[model samples]
Target: MKKTSLAGACLLALSLMMGSGAALAKTPPDQLIIGMNMNNLLTLDPAAMTGNEVVGIVVNLYDSLVELDANQLTNVKPALAKSWDISPDGKVLTFHLRDNVRFHSGNPLTAEDVVWSMRRILHLNLAQASVWKSYGFSKKNIDQQVSAPDAYTVQITLPKANDPQLVIYSLAALGNLGVLDSKTVQRHERDKDWGNHWLTTNEAGSGPFILETWQAKDVLRMKRNPDYWRGEAKMNRVVLRHFQESQTLRLMIEKGDLDIASNMAISDINALRKDPQLTVDAVQRGTMYYVAMSMKEAHFANPKVREAVRYLIDYQGINKALMPGYGVLHQRPIKAGMPSTLPDPGYTFDLARAKKLLAEAGYPDGFDTTLRVLSDQPYLNIAIAVQSTLMQAGINAKIITGTGNQVYGAMRERKFDILVGRGGSGMEPHPHSSLRALVYNPDNSDAAKLTNFQGWRTGFYDKQLNEMIDSALLERDAQKQIADYQAIQIRYDQLIPAMIPISQMVDSVVVRNEVQAYQPHPSATTFLRDVWKVDEGDKG
Candidate 1:
């Protein structure tokens, strides 16, 4: 036998490696691997979801009656509902379901599923129940609120007249409104669990993907739904590997082992922009990071003190220094891009003004206080900056940093003095979504503790503001409704509630060159249905 040359020997080794699946493992054409920090993911059940990380995953597994337009976050587009009609009184909404949609378990989508899914939200009293409860839905009345008029018709009746647009948005937007496969979910129900325990790790959705495996703090894998109503996904599988550090994600993407890095630090994203093989996208999400002062605390009970806290924030300074490419200075409960959002009103870093306000509020020397913040980047840094500035105004703030649950739990329980956190209501470009959550708190009773209502949680309530929110919901005229929202926002600004909107949150993601049509949702959700990968030679 002739002695094999070095090149021949190398070719033989390469063939053997390829045969062993090493080549396919490097960058599978049919699979998309994502690296992101998913430690915050508490549940996959849409009703209990409280974080964006889970929404990014749930949106692919489930379909809503209506969806935010991919190109425009504000515009509502058809999803499971093909068309809808509003009653003359504006208290009833009727949606005509799309035909032939099937769940992952081969159950046909129908109006009954829609009705059951919505009623389950109220019955379970999950995180999303507060939104519906505000609209007069309750465990006792949910059956009356939602009804299936026919196999393909879903009719929802509000307890009172409301803006039909907002009503539709509340049911169709992201969050808990994703219709579940009723029969399949109910079959797995044990002791009235409402499939909550089962759905935490499994999915019965009809969206573009099916949940294959979900090992918390380990990995989440989803396979393309071949029977998807819209059509099959381009990729065969999508994997979200748990990666807490941004550096590990950077290395994964650089090595061609990951298709997308969803949660990268600002510094890493900026550096990745220079790499030819990676694309860095910094998009504004429908979110705001701000400081909340609990009215339960006597030190923050005065409106003057709350107003002073607004002026004490170094918004522009913090955005430019600590939040570069991650935040934009934004002031107002409603996010900037949405309809009816008021102008900034120019709350700047005015130490003297804050000091004067503090004096007028009977804290002439300023009082020592505690500021709670999540022990995470941006939150902790923002809290530190605010702490430094407040100290100058004689307000000695002791920063208390903890996990999101620890800090936000205190706020929910009305126990924190000041909290630096992020929140957004309607990622659908609707003002009601934000206003209803950030301003309206009709019931403050411990028995009626609407913890999901951020305003109620912060102990901020004004009967006038509540009435305005209700009136805004009742107004049917688009222009008049917008004007009403504007008025409500003006009142909120004057009242100086516990919250002071600081900056709009921005998120960045790095994707490899092989990926295409990767549009980031303004809500910071990841829609992987239309995402496809191309071969190196297929690159344009």
Candidate 2:
């Protein structure tokens, strides 16, 4: 147990040390400072970012070929490409770009630039490169690659006809695959350094804003692009101020210092809802919060022990305590009714049955286990509720908490008996991304290496999942796709890799009344490109 530097302390510490809303005075609206509760932001490079903090900023500073729109369901217009056509087989895609789209460096965006940007992804094996596999891609799936048929048309062809969504996913995977100028990459390569120099901190994106300055671990500043590909951003400039204090964030929100704030405490969320000055809204998130048992802990390998642990969790109580009416209890890792929630009966909860099962497994008196949680406030409530519930069922649970990276690293190393985390699907809610990242082991499969969080890899499940994704691609029949999904979901239930889904927590955004046209997607970062401030003089 080591004390965290002030820069790393999240909202929970701020809520205790400083009164809620105290940090607001430190930042004001003329300043437009935004608060980030999560601490893990490493690099602005599209290839290096993993967590939401850095990605959130990247989303605003760069424009992708497509973006999730207001409805949060579909990718719409205003991407680098004005329009796109999908081939009959849903494999080949042709994008028609807008003319005169200029990068921040005053270079015109061309079809060749798109090719260079995407090809670079393949060449680099970037952190998010695995996401491209859905498009019939591996290390070498871009057979034909992106080609500039003309100045305004970029044609891309893949080897196989897979998901139509793949066309959009590839662009959305990174900072909108922010169009890279061909000359820029070539210059970097000539310099023997590649696009690493400029693409790292400074971007040549065609988005509404351009990166003005990035002070590592401190702040990121951007100015509205005058010659933006789409149109000008409403704000003159945006300053993303990084503060670890949750109180600082809430204060900023209350004092009109910050126009938008996220990752607020449950209590703060409830209180904010009562204020007319701000909007407290929630959407059904694609994220599923659950706990996974580490195989490294021998006792966790026992089915009875795992089931007992699952039963002892009071998910409903924890969710209610965290943010009343803000979440929906998840029956499976996926949300029910989502085309991908994947129905399974193993997600149900029963305390008595769990105790009985534990007894049958030779733990009638219950068992002692260690549970790890994140510094996020909601997780704290979950930890406490789970501890009390498990104790009643004859189990002793010790709770461990730390920063997100610390917890994630420990989980990857299999250092804890049980670890809690939230898994989110893409904007489309496709199961392939979550399934591969959490269940299928990349080491054993033909797929690229991904994060199999719970170590749930098994030959049977792995084979079945691949077959299901592949079957969906081969068959045009709706019924066949349904059947494949059912079979996969049933097998996943039998495996029970991670048990006890708490709920789906949506990405809630709080915006000022003066700010209009803000759009947020469950999967997309909270920054809204369509949103603009309604000027007092322009009030209709």
Candidate 3:
């Protein structure tokens, strides 16, 4: 046998890594290539965008008033806002803008842009408008609520008495509140849309990146804004290539073609964890994976039926079997690890009790129902497991699966009987954030069309619960506020909620070894400006 030279052995190893059908795609040193699914990305407009994928991209394209620290979530750092002050009444917040900031179009970023950006959300009444609307801001009151005091100052006077801190957190954490260049956006305005149509493809921000090109479901590329007020992004270019197949992402990351991969299957993620050059970053989120029942449904409308259905769920089996890389066993509306979050109620799979309750609700033989869930991984798995348990309790539930639009759209219309999904506003590190999203339905009327709130989507509304959430947010005493949140969780559970918390969300992202400072934020406002890369070829 002939002995190969050391360099020849290295070459042989490289060839083996790039297996058959794998392109020898080497990402540039000054470029960061990320592989993930972009199917949920419907729009580039911050005000219209949903999903975590859009959050990360939009934050880089536009700067928010403040930013939540990826490591210290409670710490709100100044971004476009240099400093801020809350009035003694807690109903007013004044933000001082950074004078040196300039949009990618070379237009100065000012208080006018900040106020206009916020007003536009209420004016358009799009996906992002719901939360602000719930805060009492509307097209009629927005101008009075949000005002540009001066060129350098923006003041937001609450339309209602609320926690100023939560409002600040909302501004910081939700990427939708990204400051837009009013002048640039106005130029593109047509049909009185406030540039919603134009901004779906274009951007007017003063962040570290400038949108270069975006092809739906294919590729999105952004070049570093060299004149960024925060300096410049470490990478010259960032490429987000869509990979619907987790296997493709696995292959690309293994071959050093992609620096980061998100939304990969749990099996693929576990397999990739074995690779020495890759690390899986599991970030815990405040959102939850829940089983929701629409109160509008006749069967689910009965409190006895709702309680029986809750008992029918196999929480332990689902969390242990299906929620390993995805989430942990969390059975409360508030996210796990928060000071105010309560422990799980220890509800187990008791078919006898479920049957008894079902009989009491006049469904002795059980009733047929439909379970709506996204066709994506872990969700469908959870639904299948749920379907099995529901069958055991004599409840015949047919699993209905579709794309995000199809399933969530049905939920939005309050037409879903049951839903297995993950949601709740975990963007802020506050208990009210999740409760407001999951439990507080201000209006039960169908005409409200508050699809952004999961509680509204499920036709779940409790007048007392809504008041509790509102009052708790306004409580200035720390201990009393915490008590209020704890009480809220207990009350939500006792009320036989339309939504049952199954597991908290844990997002896993696979990253190559050479990527540096790639912090995955819980809020999803993951700024890529600080992310740099060392040459992978420099490895010994």
TM-score of each: 0.91, 0.84, 0.92
Clashes of 2: 6
Highest lDDT, which number? 3
Q: Candidate 2: where is the Cα deviation over 4 Å? A: 1-33, 75-78, 133-144, 159-161, 173-176, 185-193, 323-326, 340-349, 442-462, 535-540
Question: Per-residue CA lDDT of candidate 1, range 14-68, in tens?
Answer: 5576578674246788998888888789799998887778988998999989877
lDDT of candidate model 1 versus the reference: 0.84
Residue-wise lDDT of candidate 2 within 1-540, one digit each (tens)? 222555345545545545643443433222345556545666666655676666777777666677665464444545777788988976678888878788777888888778777777666666656566545565565536667899888888775666666456646544536666668556656364447666666665666778788876567788777877557766767777765555566766776667777766656666677777778656666666776776556777777777777777766666656646446666565455546456445444588888898888888887788888987766777777777787888788798899876887776555677767766454454555455445554244324223443434212235665566567545556566656656666766666555456776666666666566666555555564555565434665
Candidate order (TM-score) = 3, 1, 2
Say which prediction, candidate 2 or candidate 3, comes out ahead on lDDT: 3
Q: How well does model 2 score by local distance difference test?
A: 0.64
**Runs in model 3 lying further than 4 Å from the true structure:** 1-25, 447-449, 536-540
* Cα lDDT for residue 182, candidate 2: 60
Minimal lDDT window, size 10, model 3: 1-10
Q: Which ten residues in a row have the lowest lDDT in candidate 2?
A: 452-461
Q: Kindly list the per-residue Cα lDDT of model 3 for residues 1-540, writing each as its tens digit.
A: 232354355455556866555567678999999998998888989889988999999999999999999998999999888899999888889999889999999999889999999999999888888778778899999988998879999999999888889888899888988999999999999999999999998889988999999999889999999999989889999999987667777877888889999999999999999999999999998889999999999999999999998999999988888899999998998887778888889998999999999999999999899999999878999999999989987888999999987998999899989999988887799998898888878888999887778888888888988899988998999999999999988888888999999999999999999999999999988989999988767866
